[model samples]
Target: MNIDPHKLTPRARNALSRAGLLGQSTRVYELVQSGEICYLSNIGTKTYRELCRYFGVRCDGKYPARRFKPVNAVYLKQCIHYLRGHGYTVIEPSQSHNQ
Candidate 1:
């Protein structure tokens, strides 16, 4: 479980850095349709794992899905904050929903 920080991608490194910042950080986790269902893009394994751990959600393969959104809704925006903070482009639904 000891991942070399330098070995990770910049996005993953950034995600680890923001692990503590997500608590109580609401920033609107948006939705993007991909493959069959909506999923979070630009999020590496480390980022996804960190988010799930912080949100108290199990890694059931649904963190980025529309169903498992916003860490249980109620406007607890955290994913978007991380995504935006990293300056990753948001997958626009209008542009390509089923791509």
Candidate 2:
């Protein structure tokens, strides 16, 4: 089954909705299959990360790497590993169809 962006945290969902990416033109599954999502005015790095986590995809190259504290790195790595193990497709921002 495809991941659901709506499953993201409330703050992230609000950001996405305001950005006109979520619940607007493209469905989350279509966005995933296309391998990218357009960047909007309010879709910042934090929001992007939340989207990545929600859709079970990793960020490719367009967005800068998020800097986590040393202690958090382990946790983040674990999360990534978990996502990958579950078979999520990671994509880049440049690949967004709307772009």
- Indicate which candidate wins on TM-score: 2
Q: List clash counts for every candidate, in order.
A: 1, 0
- Model 1 residue 32 lDDT score: 16
Native-vs-model 1 lDDT? 0.42
The model with the greatest lDDT is 2
Question: Which residue pairs does candidate 2 place in steric collision?
Answer: none
Q: Whole-model Cα lDDT per candidate?
A: 0.42, 0.49
Summarize candidate 1's per-residue lDDT along 1-99 as a digit string, tens digits.
344456645664565444432222333122111211123354544566554444344555644454444443324245545555665444433324333
Q: Write the per-residue lDDT of candidate 2 for residues 1-99, one digit (tens) a residue.
A: 533455678777776565445554346544443333332334556665666667667766455333221135456456546544544332322324323
